[model samples]
Target: MSENDIERLQEVLRDFAKERDWEQFHSPKNLIMALMGEVGELSEIFQWLTDSEASHLEGKVKNRAREEIADVLLYLLRLSDVLDIDLIEAAHDKLEVNRQKYPVAVFKGSSAKYNEIKD
Candidate 1:
C-alpha cells in the first residue's frame, strides 16, 4: 500500500532478504535461475486452460498466478541489481532500438522480430 519509486521498492525487498541473511543465496546466476523457475510457475496456471477459461479465473485463481508472477519480478529485480543493470533505463534504451528495428508502421500489427521485415 505504499507509493514508492522503483529503487525504493527494490531496496525494501533487498532489505527484507538481507534481514534473513538471504543475500548470500542471491548470486546473479541463482537469481536468474529463480526467475526462470518463477516464470514456469506462472505459466503453469494456464498451461492447458483455454483463453476463455484462463480469463474466467480473473478473480480467485488469479491470486496463485499473481504470487508466481511476483516471485518472477522479485528475482528479476534482484538479478538486475546484482548485475548492475538499470532495468528502467535499459528498457527505455531498448525501446528506442526496437523502434529503429521495428518501425511502428511495420510492427503495429505483426509480432515479427527485427530482421523479418521484407526489404
Candidate 2:
C-alpha cells in the first residue's frame, strides 16, 4: 500500500480508538503485545501445511488466512501509530539496508545470512 493509504488507515484507527475511549489502552507496549499475538494466530494457520499447501490456500482456509493477516496488519499499524513511526518510510529504509547487506551479485538465490556469506 501507499503511504497515503497507510496514513488513511492510521487516521481511521485513531478515530475508532477515540470513539471507544481506547487511546488510554493503546500504549506502544500493549500494541506490540497485541501485534505479536495476531502474528502467532496468523502463523498457526500455516503451521501444518506443506510448502505447496501453504502457497496455495483454498476457500475457507484462504478466507481465514486473510482474516488473520488483517488482524496482524491492524495491530502492526496501531503499534506503528502508537510509536509515532512512519512504517512506509521505515520499510523503504530497511529495504535499502537489506539491498546493501544482500547484494544480488553475491547473494542471488542464496538463503545465507549476511554474516555467513564468504567473499
Best by TM-score: 2
lDDT (Cα) of model 2: 0.93
Q: How high is the lDDT of residue 23 in model 1?
A: 92
Residues 1-119 of candidate 1 have per-residue lDDT tens digits of 23246677688888988999999999988888888888998998999999899878876578998888788878877888778788888888999987798888878989888778787
Off by over 4 Å in 2: none
Residue 79, candidate 1: alpha-carbon lDDT = 84
TM-score of each: 0.87, 0.97
Q: In candidate 2, residue 21 scores what lDDT?
A: 100
lDDT of 2 at 3: 92
Model 2: C-alpha RMSD to truth? 0.8
Cand. 1 TM to true fold: 0.87
| Angstrom error at residue 16, model 1 | 1.4
